[model samples]
Target: MVEIAAWLRARQAEGTLRELVDLDHLGHGRVRLADTEGPALLDFSSNDYLALSEHPALIAAATEALQRYGTGAGAARLMSGNFPVHQELERAVAALKGQEAALLFGSGYSANVGIIAALMGRDDVIFTDRLNHASIYDGCRLAGAGIARFRHNDLNHLEELLASQPVKGTRLIVVESVYSMDGDRAPLHELVALKERYGCLLMVDEAHATGVFGANGGGVIEEAGVASGVDLAMGTFGKALGSYGAYVAASRRMIDFLVNRARSFIFSTALPPAVAAASLAAVQLIQQEPGLRQELHQRVALFKGYLRQAGFAGDLGPSQIIPLRLGSSATAVAAAERLRAHGLFVPAVRPPTVPEGTARLRLSITRHLGEAELAAAAAALVACCLR
Candidate 1:
């Protein structure tokens, strides 16, 4: 206990200690932090891109499911936890991604970790993007696979690494459709071609792209017209769909293999039937309403324009997740505090979420904010940074 206390003190001294900040209320793109007794601030730190968490349809479905199936799944999925709503949600996800089958996990982390560890082993080699989510890296390590990292979004570098495979057995390449931190997109078309040429299996993590890209929210692979080429695709409903849990959409055989082999899925209790029902309803809503995507993009564009007009320069990519680099963890935290003072809730993203000296403010855009609200938030951000 003393050693743990010392370790925590060391972390605090280095400005790396983290604490949980409760939100008294979270809705309508604002949150009332428990520590603050003031009104809710405009939230730019959320992952609710489509703002469907409070949507009537999702709420209704969850309510109905709760009344019918109760709250918990009671057992592991392989035992007695697999509910009809679970299978129904999987089918909806599979259909959305244009895959033959899909399997659910507790969250995106479990899905990535379980799938990678299940599919690859000591004899296999996995190539991943350097800027891929930490979950992906954890999965690679857990699998005991020889891992190689390519420069972020650099297909040429990826090819060079692929050509120089030192140990080769069941080569698999992993990348995200839209990188969460940087908000940039992967070159899916080029990656698909390269994977085919190199005879490597490809996995695309669409956690940030699902319900935010493609005509039917099928993500970047579908937008690139290479959905058929990618071998495995993983996504989370907790983000844009504004629900909980994750899924891996793949061929029927691959899904079946995971069902039998993935320890995370087999060992963990299944998602509550209410969550499954809510996620299914959210997916259905996303498919039915394409206008939500359009509106979200428009707000993003407007926010970016505001930032550019204010002479704040950083890589604001084409996607809704924007990162404003602040160079150091201390500076990023200070900036976040300043934003909070201005009634904005954009949190500072520090290492190991980002590399040292590359700390940032990860701003996520959602459709709930109107044009005026976006403009005001952008102006506040610019002012906070300038100060």
Candidate 2:
């Protein structure tokens, strides 16, 4: 206990200790501190890119499923937890991702860990980005695979690492389409070509790109027209879809392989029927109402424009997730607090969420914010973040 206290004190002294801040959701992309009487803050911390979390259709689907199927999947998927809704949702996801089949997992963490571990072993080698999600690192560890981490989005470095590997060994390359903290996109087309050249399997994590990029909200792979070249397209409904679960779209054979060998999927209880239903409804809404994506991009542009107009010179990147790089953890935390005082709730991102010396505020834009809210948030951010 004393050791743990010392560790926590060390974190606190370094300005990296985290605390939970409870907020009351007031809807329309606004929230307020649960214990405070301050005005609602413009929410820029959510990943609900299309603002579909509160959509009526998703609500109706979840409500119906709950009333009919109960509140939980009472057993593991291999036992009695599997439902038609789960399978139906997988089908929809597979079709949307332009794949032959799909498999569902309880959460994105379990999905990534299980999928990667199931696909590789001690004899296999996995190449991933240095900035890949932590779950991927855990997965690689579980697999006991030889791991090579390339610099972020550096194709040349990736190829150099790939060329040094054994020709007969199983090789897999995994990366995220859009980086969560930096908001930069991976070059999927070039990545596909490199994988093909080296006879390696490619897996693209589209957790941030799904429901926001492709015409049918497929993901960056779809937009890049390289779906056929990639082996696994992994995504989560918890973010853009505003639901709780994750999936991998791949060949029928690969899905079957994971079904048999993926311990996380085989042993864990299936997702609640209502959760699957909600995801399905959200997917349908994304396809039917394309304007939501358009409006979101426009809002991003508008907010970025306001910042640039205010003489801010930070790189906001190409996606909805914007990082205002404030040099140190203390600086980033202070900027976030200042923004909070101005009615904006932006979290300060720090190591190991980001690398040391690269702390920033990770601002995620969603369609829920109106033009006026975007303008106000931008002005607040500039005033609080800039010198």
Candidate 3:
């Protein structure tokens, strides 16, 4: 006990330790129910971008699946738990993304780790964006690939780093289509050109872009018309899909390779049948309801407009996830508290999730929020900025 306590104390002394905040008092969206807090705050923080978290259709699908197949898969897909729901989801996701095949994982976090590590290894060279999701970074590390990080979204830096290397062994370039933190997008066209020039494979994490972009809601790869160009595209059902699962859309060969090689996929239990059913329903809904995307786009535009009109000071980008940069973690935390005090919920994203000195409030907008809600949240944000 003394030894463990000493180790924990060391981390706290170095300012790298974290203590999870109690969410018992939190409400939905960005507002959490803290024990010390009063009143329900307006939520602007949830990753449920489509507001499908509580959608009746999704809920019904999940309930049906649970009734039909029970709550758990009971085994890995390759083993006894290969349910019909999983097969249906794989096929549905493949068709939705216009890919040859799709493989399901427990979560986007595991999908990225499992797929990347399985595909690339010690001999591979993985070029990554600095702002890519931590799952990507971990995947690269797990693969034991030599990693080279370029500046965030800087193709020139990427090219320069690639050029400096005399031998490119199994080159893999990784990036997020829409960075989760800054809410900015990747230059897919330029990335395609670079990949073509270097003869490298590209892996895109569309976790944030799924259900938010594309004519059919496939994500940035489809939105940019690079679905066929990218070697692998991964996304999460947890976000806009309003469920819990992750998938990799790729060629049949790649899918098969992951099936045999990805340790996480092999060892972990398959996603619950209910979640898979709900995800399949979510996929169908995304395609059938183009209005959802349209409305979300309108909300994004409206939020940005409100910021511009109010002259709110922050890095408000094109994506739905807007970063209200406060520059310091302490200040960001304080501002979040201030917003919460006004019945507005916004979490302060501190270091590790974001780079140092760039701690901010990550505000995500969705179509579920009406114009009045948007305006009110924006006004509150602006007031917080002013303070």
TM-score of each: 0.97, 0.98, 0.94
Residue 153 displacement in candidate 1 (angstroms): 1.1
Q: After superposition, how far is residue 242 of candidate 1 from its true place, in Å?
A: 0.7
The candidate 3 region of ten consecutive residues with least summed lDDT is: 23-32
Per-residue lDDT of 77-143 in model 1, one digit per residue for the tens?
Answer: 8899989999998899899999999999999999999999999999899999999999999999999
Q: Which rank order by lDDT, best down to worst?
A: 2, 1, 3
User: Per-prediction RMSD in angstroms?
Assistant: 1.5, 1.1, 2.3
Model 1: pairs clashing at backbone N, Cα or C within 3 Å: none
Per-residue CA lDDT of candidate 3, range 171-241, in tens? 99999999998889999989989998988899989999999999999888888898878888889999999
lDDT score for residue 157 of model 3:
99
Ranking by TM-score: 2, 1, 3
* lDDT minimum window of 10 residues, candidate 1: 10-19
| Native-to-model Cα distance after best TM-score fit, residue 354 in candidate 2, in Å | 0.8
- CA lDDT, every prediction? 0.90, 0.92, 0.86
